[model samples]
Target: MDLYRNIPRKDKLLSLFNDDYAKTILNYAIDQELSNLRKLIADNKIHKIDEQLLIKNIDKRYNELISGSLKRVVNATGIVLHTNLGRAPLSEDFIHNIKDIVSRYSNLEYDLEKGVRGERYHHVVEYLKIITNCEDALVVNNNAAAVFLINNTFNKGKKVIISRGELVEIGGSFRIPEVIANSGAILKEVGTTNKTKISDYENAIDEDTTMIIKIHKSNYAIIGFTDEVPYREIPKIAQKFGLLSYCDLGSGSIIPGIGCNEPTLSEIYNYGYDLVSCSGDKLFGSVQAGIIIGKKKLIEKLKKNQLLRMLRVDKITLSLLQETLKAYLTDSYNNIRSVNLLGTPLTDLLKKAKKLKRILNRHLSDYFDFETKEITSYTGGGSCPMHEIKSYAVICKSKKIDINKIENFLRKYHIPVIIRLVDNKIVLDVRTIFEDEFVLIKDALVWATNQLS
Candidate 1:
């Protein structure tokens, strides 16, 4: 009758698990499971405890404790640069090629030519300069860090004139005004939120104004009688007054005709901005980095800033970014996974979807119906909000089982299949799903059907 005594001892429960897990972890799982069982007994939720059920619960707990939160999942949502799914997915082949360099020590900072300590930013700066046609370049942890470094370096304790319409907030509550304030630069907002002209920036500039920054509204668009000074015009205003000019091309792009009216890096540079910064992981399609490219003298000054050390990236990031830049320089767009996905032709996507549908139907015909559907995909990660890419998705429907249940099962599977439900149907957009991941999707479908059946 006493349910407390029904709980097994720690050692007995621990013996059920293997030595693959640490003793402490095993003990913790057992203790937590037993504690839960005790709570259930206290709540009078059950008359008695089942030994098998208790063992099963402990086993589940042990697995949960040992499992890592960062597991690879199939990105079936069709968002090429899904921020939640780790902005940009690096190429496995590329990572494999650079494994020796990243895994082992190889002159990350040592200058092989001069046989002396060298700058880490030097590795990718040349490539960036060539690709972007900039005088110099620097890489920090992310775009926000690049912006922070620029603010702290030049505009700290000075006024930074920016258009109110361009004051943008990106993912994770990263607001422009907050970043400037945190960097010790005073923010001077000019013009209305929906409309700001060149005069707004000109009037806001004073002796205290050290710089004028034009930020790209990457995530959203302002419509209906909107007037803002073009980025190209800012440098002229700054030149006339002998002040610094910078533009935050949030989710900056190098590839022209990438759509969504996103200006290329070269175009921005030609506009005569003194400094420019963008995200490496977004439209750039590399590792996560804040890429700052501008005049050589200004870049040198940024390198000397003490905060650069804190914002600097590791060798792995540099290596990945360098490889991505090489791909761009050589016109090897296929090597860049994000670029390839974004540029995948509609015909190719339809073929991929058809192949995937055949594979799924061959295995899972009884429980579900599979068909290809044309859908819209986005260049997510705040790069282009209005632009939509034509994509193909495998729509799955079931009559015997609830559609939501199937979706939940796929999501909770060992290898989660991140999917979307469209009008009570499961949608798997093949735009973001790699060909190699087809097997995983098939397996996930099989696993879901088996569990649901």
Candidate 2:
């Protein structure tokens, strides 16, 4: 029989699509099952139909479909602010703080004192002001929204003079020029790519210029003979022309130890910036959001602007951000996960690596090469581009299964183990991995070795 003739039609495969099979996997689309069954029929013959195997395949497909693609993976990359694995995992205790808040209704927008509607940002603004010493503060969905609000609220159809060197591309391909242009503002880039002076900004200012903006190159660094004006210098020039001054601290820095040289929010405010914007998920170690703090008048303009309504944060985001901010006011070292993870001392990491080595070497020694070595982790999420987090990694390699095979096998485990492969070796950075999760790592490696053998 011809190959196409052997393939079953929908009506022909009705037995499998009946009440038991179809209803069992109602969560998953049957179309995929049809495609796979048809291919199987074509590969074999009509007489070779495997009902039991088909049902087994259906069960596997159903499990994959029900468990959404975004399954939680263990971050062994050692990057504290890993962008892919949900940058800055909130501390379990901090999440517990907001569980009751999210479980029931609270005064999100209602003012209990006067029996009137209150502002959503009122939840975090006072805390933000207290921390940064800003006159006023507001919260948006993310830092990009804060940047867009600045441009849309103040510089619509007007010019925003910025240094060419400071024109940065944030994560997910969102560029500075694109954000400004999309916000209904004009981008008047000044200075050269490697050099921009206070005079460069001063020279670009004209009657059309509404603000002088500076963007932190959060993800990249340029060294050797590069000249840039102080963050304070740009706003000083803007003040001379009666213009607003804003700085988008891309991966918002509140802690000094996380990203080595990134300026703190308080330090940036002290530098005379009229408005400062930051992301909550980055170094703030909270939810994904933009925090804007500045003079009361400027913030009021953003709050009252119609654009704010479009870019405003929801109740849950506001609540989570409020709790995350509370972490900073208290003991940030104990509260924030990224702060503790990134700030994990080299001595501590060495201790962890030794402990991991003892566990893994006992089980994985036969199948793989196990050695403890000093490794470098990054401050990911485009915060500290090439800066290294000195740490220790259990460097693993197998003679039977290559690094690619090891990586693929580890991913198939119940809790996916994400490891970094550098220098033709499988590196498991133990900084981000919890001590409790070590059992899963052991099981995965054992299973992988058995399968390969």
Candidate 3:
């Protein structure tokens, strides 16, 4: 103590041990440093570490170990198909299929009939082409990859015509111009941001133009005094120039009702687009995938691209997606979770609201004012931005707690009840909630009431 007392704080701390203890501490510290250093090296981000910052670096590693890893959380934010919450939840049928294939090595690349090696894409290709009535089809990891493959294979170093209005930036700060740039294709902007005429596309066409690309504004819409060239018109323009007509229907929906603006895959195929690309997990309600369908020649070219191999779907994605496609093929539409949620009637929603009210009343009648009222639920997941389906919900009245606090409390409950703060009370919309989720709703309410007490 006397030997260390006169030393400065920094030097004393670094030298608080004898030679043997110092060697052991330094070795352990070196091991810890090397553990982190190895990770940086693996990530190709390695750099020189400062010895002076060793203590601060150690603190970061200790903090990471204690942090919660990815775990299931209740979606009480009212954003169904919330991107952060893994987008769309897989249907039971799809989940079972995935488990079965993953548990045992099924015929992932082996053909049962031919008794030989088969392509993995054969699983979903026929179904996708049949469902969309396209000449050929392909699947990739995501819609972005689909676009990249299509552009890179077909229009690399060539001009791609697009409307300025439809060049939208969806979630994740991803922009259309950026994707075009990344594909090594020249983006020939046709018209103004809100208005683009067919003539603008016609004038933009030249010897350098290889394709006419139409992008759907999945997340936003321009209403009132907006003018844009219809998708059908572009196919003719492409035909005139002997170029391909490609529509990147970002959020493709097959089951259409209740005011959805998404154009179906069949609709685009019928109208005469040579190629169509869309996301599987958005309106189609499948696992994350990119489904591209089009002319046989063009699709064959895309399949031959070297990049296609890199962006190909895995065994799990193909297995689950095959089951999801079967669900669509069957007449039973309720098997699809997103479709069922979209098609749920107000009367059905009201019944759920009443049941929820009864459950809440059993726990705490004094805490809330319960009433079934008309409400609107959006077809989220960027399918229909302007459309809101009319629904019913149970509005809770709370005098002691503010609407935000009630919502926060319900959200933090074990089952996590997503409630809307309506007219200063926590409102429960039954449209998005599943009929089977009643038990969860009851438990969440019970938990919330206990919190208040």
lDDT of all predictions: 0.89, 0.83, 0.77
Worst 10 residues of 2 by lDDT: 5-14
Among all candidates shown, the one with the greatest TM-score = 1
For 412-452, candidate 3 gives per-residue lDDT tens digits of 66455656675687767776666667677767766676676
TM for every model, in the order presented, reads 0.94, 0.93, 0.82
In terms of lDDT, which candidate is stronger, 1 or 2?
A: 1
Question: Which is the winner by lDDT between candidate 1 and candidate 3?
Answer: 1
Per TM-score, what order, best first?
A: 1, 2, 3
Best by lDDT: 1
The true-versus-predicted C-alpha distance at residue 162 of model 3, in Å, is 0.6
Model 2 residue 59 lDDT score: 63
